[model samples]
Target: MSIDLQSKLTPLPRLYKEITLDVGGEAVHLIIRRPPRTVMAMLLSEARKAGELDEQDKPKDGGCAMRLMARMAASVLYAPDGVRPLYDRKNPEVIENLVENAEWLLDIQEDVVGALGANGAVVERIQGNSEATQT
Candidate 1:
């Protein structure tokens, strides 16, 4: 007897965008995808544990934000040629490579975070659903 292993749910495609960044005088073409919720959750958890905050809200661990930025860059970064992922989120070596290019990585992370947070339409609908549930 064969059981249906396929999911019955419809697939929702993730958002993607392309960009070219100048890294150390080299033109790097990247395809950035909106990070999935799991990656976002991991980012949040990593950020929370990466530093301590006092009343002034100053980060005691200076590398915390940088590490998060590296992770974000790793998560969303993809090669434009075949849409290949340049780095794996689970691999520290690949993440460290991103850290080495901190200057340009910051720019890459900016775009990645923008993609992650750019779901204005979805946010509105989700907020509406929450409001309706509370009513």
Candidate 2:
């Protein structure tokens, strides 16, 4: 029997959420896109460069973790239409932007992380499973 690799290897669905923030007096709309599986490696590389990770690629500290969350939020940010990426993975400007708006990073981080399986939905589902179901 011949196997079809293309049919077996399906891409992960892109996750995103539409958000609105009050920047100054006006409400600014944006899309928070979850980093696609294809760019996970690049994002990790960026985290390392931003000092969020050590040489071993492990998290350095709490502060670094915060920075990483901010970086993730920043890189995944998109235009309100959700089609245009506001920040490019290859652009160093994202780091500068994150630094300049450090105060908002945590807020953004919560939303970004919350979007992940509704913030631990998968874990909760697995944990709620009964022993009989495990069989």
Candidate 3:
């Protein structure tokens, strides 16, 4: 028996997440969208561009890292409950917090890199250790 070509076709899996943060005793929510191929392409292109940053690329307040985090935050993030249009939440304080407390961000990066076949170790480690098991 031969395999059906249609049955062999599968779409790439995407992983989405909702991350919550506490700032000044208020809940801040982020609906983090998983990057599809197009978004990933844009990210890669932007990263390459970042490496060639000139003097003008620097923020006046010396917040290059915050700016980068803000850009990434803006790209994938859906606003919290009270916010609208997403851009409203991309402020300095919110962006600073995202850059400061970014454990989940690293996890997402590892997952994306693993899914893209760039970092086998991350997937392997997660699989081998069962780290993703939730209580």
Candidate 4:
């Protein structure tokens, strides 16, 4: 399952363009940068080379990696500068909606990743994806 998802999805780009959000009277702009593939590759390779899964109790199906990615994505999406407005003195509902959406996305990502095996490459891909949306 992990392999299939990895194959289906392309690696996220190195840097995503800046996005602007209207926060009350101010506009907040930010950019999400993709994590270096080398870093991800090294991390995964080290884990595999260590051959210490038994000691670490790492999931055989990359569950850990999936969760990490999901959480990371959720964090960004919920950030004040991300989807939700930063200082909307007039509207508080927008913030609530954004939080709800972010939570939903996080849950879905977790479920999807959990079903997939803990593949090093897939994990790396997810990290890349998270970085791509970091803004």
Candidate 5:
């Protein structure tokens, strides 16, 4: 006997983005997923610590931004070589490498988040076809 099972479709699909970097002249890509609610909470915590958030509902400047960016990159950036969680770096050499490339890492992270928001943004135009087209 054969059986089939299917679940109802969700209104939205998860989003993913890929960024390529030059590491030792070799191309490396970090694929990132749009962070879920839990992950977003974590990110906000880090941002608050880094002075990126404030009670006045504005961003503040602080020295911890680099560290926060590195940590955020570690959270989202996935490696093809299976090196996981750069935030918990134990290898001194890898830690140094990431520190040296902190700016680039932040750049990639921002790019991924930006693209995810820009491309995945939704719009509703009642006059248009109702196939859930985007703006």
Candidate 6:
């Protein structure tokens, strides 16, 4: 029996406008902005440069300074938390959580792009998974 996989495939769901926060809040709207490719490239380049710095010279945290900056920018755009630690040393668990979250975000991004029929860029596969399932 020849199964028509193309017919079986469904478009991924679009992201929701509002997200519920962990802290008490009614509704939070999402604003999607596509950062310029040049800006993203510059940020990645800076992160690579910062990663090369010696441990003593570098920030105490586990090479999260660049990521922290990006996260801070995102927070400012959405949540607006005034105080953010330069180095999050005590939170090893948080790093793991961030890694997981990053993976999720990447998958969502790829799905969105694929749904929109964009091509050429390579998509990274999720680690330790035999198959990709729709969420």
Q: lDDT for each of the candidates?
A: 0.57, 0.56, 0.44, 0.39, 0.46, 0.33
lDDT of 1 by residue, 34-112 (tens): 7666676675455455443223222334454456567667777777654435787667676666667557876555577
TM-score for each model: 0.61, 0.58, 0.40, 0.27, 0.50, 0.30
Report clashes for each candidate as comma-separated counts: 0, 0, 0, 4, 0, 0
- TM-score of candidate 6 to 2 decimals: 0.30
Question: Can you list the residue pairs that collide in candidate 5?
Answer: none
lDDT of 5 at 119: 25
- The C-alpha local distance difference test score for the whole of candidate 6 amounts to 0.33
- State the lDDT of candidate 4 residue by residue for 40-122, as single tens digits: 34434444454422233343344434333433332232232343312231233443444344344343443333333335445
TM-score of 2: 0.58
Off by over 4 Å in 6: 1-25, 52-135
lDDT of 6 by residue, 5-69 (tens): 64355322232222333323444333332333343334334444646223222322433443433
* Candidate 1 lDDT trough over 10 residues, lowest sum: 126-135
Model 4 vs. true fold: TM: 0.27
After superposition, which runs of candidate 4 have C-alpha atoms over 4 Å from their true positions?
1-14, 19-30, 43-65, 70-135
Write candidate 2's Cα lDDT for 26-135 as tens digits.
77787876665545456667776766665555556655555555555656777865454576545556655665674666656556655442324322221232221211
The pairs that clash in candidate 3 are none
Residue-level lDDT of model 3, residues 1-135, one tens digit each, is: 334654355432343566676655776776655444564345434533655223333222334433443445455555544222254233556656655765455445433343344234323332333332332
Q: Which stretches of candidate 3 lie over 4 Å from their true place?
A: 1-15, 52-70, 80-135
lDDT of 4: 0.39
Q: Give the lowest summed-lDDT range of ten residues in model 5.
A: 120-129
**Which model scores highest in TM-score?**
1
Q: Which portions of model 2 show Cα errors greater than 4 Å? A: 1-15, 49-51, 61-63, 114-135
Ranking by TM-score: 1, 2, 5, 3, 6, 4
